[model samples]
Target: MRYLCLIIAISLSSSAVFATEDMDAKLDNYRSAVGKLMKVLKPELVNAMKSKGPVAAIEVCNTKSPTMTNAVSQETGFVIQRTSLKPRNVSNTPDEWETKVLNQFEDRKAKGESPKKLEFYEIIENDGKRQIRYMKAIPTSKPCTICHGEMIPPPVQAKLKELYPADKAIGFKVGDLRGAFSIIDTITQ
Candidate 1:
């Protein structure tokens, strides 16, 4: 009677707590993976920009980024990469879910959310498989403007055209939504 009701309440509350803890663990893992990737890639980009210039930095993005991304993915055991609504790389065109998140990110930004503080995640069950999908907003900074800005140097622009025939990643202002780092993890239970 009363005792049975108390037991059920405790059980339900404990399950909710466990669910929240699980989500926290997953979020920690996803954040670590993104940090590792930025760590591995940022130094190279800085050096390339300092010594060889933006055109050379473009080469870094074209040649080095994919290899580095794959290595980081292997190290973290997650499929992670950058994607955008206007992707410089055709291969980085967002999938349906990613597109939806990117749009939501935009909407949030419009409502005064800081780009660096913008993030979203969901555990989705699709076709009997569970997946955790996450995205963190990539804010456009001044340094990135050299390559991805509205006013590009002719040489840099030419190099970009040569490298990416259908580049649409330009025209971003500082503090704008450049894109996002996306992560996907398959959960088996």
Candidate 2:
């Protein structure tokens, strides 16, 4: 009986350690995927803004963002996308799970948490299949204001209207929560 009790205790402790390690691994994978997506997209946006202007940069986002996201997804073998409560693109609107997560992020930000450091992940199991979901908050920056700020230039506004007629990703200032990068993946155990 003593040996059985010892063995059970050890097993429970070891499983806790393994669960923690597993969570760490999942975080690493999710963070790397977000980094890669940013790396692929940020430079082009910067260059577009620098070379032409906010209007041209808007075009780049309209035409190139999906391609860039898809390429990153292919490279990383992960399903990744961006979402927001107020999305410039309708397709980028948050779904049910994402909506709940976005609201949580907003509440966290309101409580003085740094948006840049805000991230959430979940391990969901359904019918014996495991899925992982993660989201990292995206904070609005100065450059983003050129297109998404309260004072967008007329040309930028016209272009934005032309491309994203139903856009809601505006009226943001630096340090505001713009949205998040969301990733979903299934992992084999």
Candidate 3:
């Protein structure tokens, strides 16, 4: 049984690495799709801010769906609206998410480069081997800080609370990495 367990572990680790690679490829595709949308959306959002005001721009963000999957906001641990590919699910606790991705952003931030985005790779450990399974993250910008920043406006705070009752996503600055792309691959076990 011990030997069987070891074999299973080794197999899982190997599969996890392959999964991570596959997820990375998918994340790249997702970025390309969203990058195209941002080109048009950014300008429009900026225009709305100038004419209708920041609220209008925020409203647009609230409604926009850059991807079909929901994206995580690293700042508050809140998931953003329709963005990302399927299989990108939220964790029950902030710690769970942090262990998986947010801490990496913090590490990058400590290095002086803001984590503008993140890619989550699922790592599986079996025996003595480790491998990545999948990855994903969200794009961040100045506006993202309004809600995720160190000081969230009351309206934004209220909205966030409503959307995420157990939210911890907040206290971020402009140009900071708001979230990362996550990758999850299937284990070949």
Report the Cα RMSD per candidate: 3.3, 3.2, 8.6
Candidate number achieving the greatest lDDT relative to the actual structure: 1
TM-scores of the candidates in the order shown? 0.87, 0.86, 0.49
Query: Candidate 1 lDDT, tens digit per residue, 97-168?
Result: 999999999999999999988899987766676778899888888888888998999999998998899999
Candidate 3 regions exceeding 4 Å error are: 1-27, 34-41, 66-99, 112-114, 117-120, 123-140, 150-169, 183-189
Task: Report the C-alpha displacement of residue 108, candidate 1, in angstroms.
Answer: 0.7
Question: Which is the leading candidate under TM-score?
Answer: 1
| CA-lDDT, candidates in order | 0.88, 0.86, 0.51
- Per-residue C-alpha lDDT of model 2 across residues 66-157, encoded as one tens digit per residue: 88888878887878999999999999999888999999999999999999999998776655666688999989988888888999999889
Write model 3 residue lDDT over 75-179, tens digit each, in one string. Answer: 223233222211112342333433545666556667876344444444565445443333334545776666557777787667666656656556655654555
Q: Model 2, residue 108: what's the lDDT?
A: 95
Ranking by TM-score: 1, 2, 3
Q: Which stretches of candidate 1 lie over 4 Å from their true place?
A: 1-18
